[model samples]
Target: MSSDRQPIPPTRPTGHQIIAPGHTFATVSDKISSIVLTRRTPLYWFIPFLIASALLMVFLVAVTALLVRGVGLWGIKVPVMWAWAITNFVWWIGIGHAGTLISAILLLLRQSWRNSINRFAEAMTLFAVACAGMFPLLHLGRPWLFYWLFPYPNTMNVQPQFRSPLVWDVFAVSTYATVSALFWYVGLIPDLATLRDRARNRGARIIYGILAMGWRGAASHWQKYETASLLLAGLATPLVLSVHTVVSFDFTIAILPGWHSTIFPPYFVAGAIYSGFAMVLVLAIPLRAMYGLQDLITMRHLDNMAKVMLATGEIVAYSYIFEAFISWYSGDKYEMFAMWNRMTGPYAVTYWTLIFCNLVFPQILWVKKIRTNVVWLFIVSVDVLVGMWLERYVIIVVSLHRDFLPSSWGIFHPTIWDVATYVGTLGLFFFLFFLFIRGLPMISIFEVRTLLPQAEVAEVEQ
Candidate 1:
């Protein structure tokens, strides 16, 4: 490690200081603020931001065409009624789960390391949900009539098919999005106040001031803030399970052979968290280097997150084995064929690719050096994302493509629009993230302050 990486303090252990030594409360604030206020956007950030912007334009044009021409522009048809759009929806929703795990679940469990990473993780969650939320709305063929999915007083007097899993999806995703946004914004309040206090210009001062909502960092204010955060964490923990479980319901509730298993709920939830942690590492490694955040987000954090990826990935691997085993064990030929088709059918390459991506690659993480190394960790993270996506493709498209009647079997191919919409959401996610890094304190300033040794000594004295 370079000297710039971190200078160890004599009193502090290798893992201590969560924030490096030699930082006071003011310095912590200054350090994070310098990233946003003092530093110019580096070429590293600018190039990706520019690319994301260009892709956002492609997304807009693609979506406009989708609305104008209807669902026919995509390759979705009879046997593969739900294809790329639903796959992307599930994939994005899964990616969002790590945010909730880091922010809500770990907070409840009293993981102090979560402090440095949770702010950005929560932001990623909100954006991932945004990307996830778009697909189902667009899937509503007429989309303009999507409000009909809600309960409303109407002359026709129809309500959403309350029992349908897709309806459950509407409720689950919307509730998750709402809670995630609220949770993220509430966490931002204290940091926003920091920005407000430090603002050099009137415009920024006023904008951040308004958003700060009179937070003066008083004892009473902090008491109320902590109380609100605990309550929100309680609410959000269930959502971490509920949102993806309901998403899995979109498949398990069906009579389709591969989709009908009871294991789908936990299986999907594990996969969601699995992919989410991967994405966080994927984003964090590059970011830690670019923004010089290695000290704050240390190798310890990387090692821990990599351990999480390996463990949850093992669960996902179990689900894969059980899915195959149960399909073969059951006397149902349809179930048998769905499993076989996934392994040996027309899209066999995708199924095998998914296995390699999800299973083969993550095995490298068990080697301690690789898990702790950014380059190796980043490669594995990208593979996890690809594998999880291919997992969705296998589940939705492969199962649907070869169901029931032999005569009806057909393959689903994404049109330019399908590919564009998925890529566009990536563009949008990156764009939002770039804006986030630019405007806000990416680390929780107050939380990191709490980790300082002096704060702990003060608490002990009190």
Candidate 2:
């Protein structure tokens, strides 16, 4: 009875309380601006950037080698044609989706929590897509003729054949990258203006002013800004669904047993969000600690993102299970054998790793405490991100290394070149992100300030 004494009142969080209390417009502005302006650069930032730049150099070296030697330097061969390059392309593209999902989709749904995170997420989208777009272009036999994929009228009257799924991907990815860049830039305008007005030095003021594009922050400007963002979100929501659907078509349109599934479009979309959100958490954990913005990005934000990962991860697991079931249920010998191969073939280690990392490990998140715990959540995010990469590898390589004919069967082993290229892209992504954190406001300062209660209308006028 004593232990069961009267319960305390349950409190609810209001819209204004989405941000921490006592954070005024000036406070939010100062907190975010100080990182880029007043505070000296952190050593951790320099160390990582230096390492990333070194890897970027390696990437340049590897690309030069590939161009000079042709695509023969990599381990890609007859049966294992789609190897590490395509896998990296898909993984990067999938990782890019979380940014749009957070910036556009969640905005459409009116989630206030996203206000603090969408800026960097949108930036991540643009950078990830840039990296993803590189693979297909570099894999071209004549890297110099990469522009042939575009729909421009040639002097010789040549044009890109829109009938190809590869062509569809060209449109899908380019469009996605362009919209992501514009969306990201538009979001930055107000914040850039804040930086512009607050700059103590003429150099800082001029740099930020150009980026701000003469934003006056008038009421009419706010109205137009809201309208444009809403319309862009509408345009982007379907691109998220269609881009990956086109990616899945690259496999599904094939005659191969493992590749010709009808369920691939939705499955790919779900997998994209799953991996994308994992990358978000992976970045969020480190950034939150490094920036000392724990109050701004609390456990509540982490908990909510963990829930999205859990939901999407389950969809991915279901897709995997359904693929196997359909293969068995159809009684197609090649499909059944392909499913068996995934479970027990030479690449069984990879297959089971995908299952354990994507399916099994995420199950721990069903416990609230573990999902919210910093260490556990970070580990889970890392596991899922790696698992998604393995999932892409298994899907592409395993499917190709053993197709319909036993005579054509072979193995795929990534060469030093493959590893170097992937590592190089990693460095490039971090390099761009480092520059972003150093120069621009990583968090949306104005949006965060909106989450705190504003002064009364009369008080503002006075």
Q: Top model by lDDT, which number?
A: 1
Q: For candidate 1, write residues 62-156 as lDDT tens digits.
A: 88998999988889999998999999999999999999999999888777788889999998998999988889888888888888988899999
- TM-score of model 2 (CA atoms): 0.95
lDDT by candidate, in order shown: 0.89, 0.88
Off-target runs (Cα >4 Å) in candidate 2 are 1-14, 455-462
Pairs with steric clashes in candidate 2: none
Model 2 RMSD in angstroms: 6.6
TM-score of 1: 0.95
Model 2 C-alpha lDDT per residue in residues 1-462, reported as the tens digit of each score: 134844311111236555667787788899999888888899988998899899889989989999999888888998987788889999999999999999889888878788888888888888899889888888885779988889887798988878889999988999999989999999999999999998888999999999999998998888778879888999999998899999999999888878899989999999999989888888888998999988788778889999999999999999999999999999999999998999999999999999999999999999999988989998999999899999889889999989888998998888999999888899888888888999999999877876666632323454
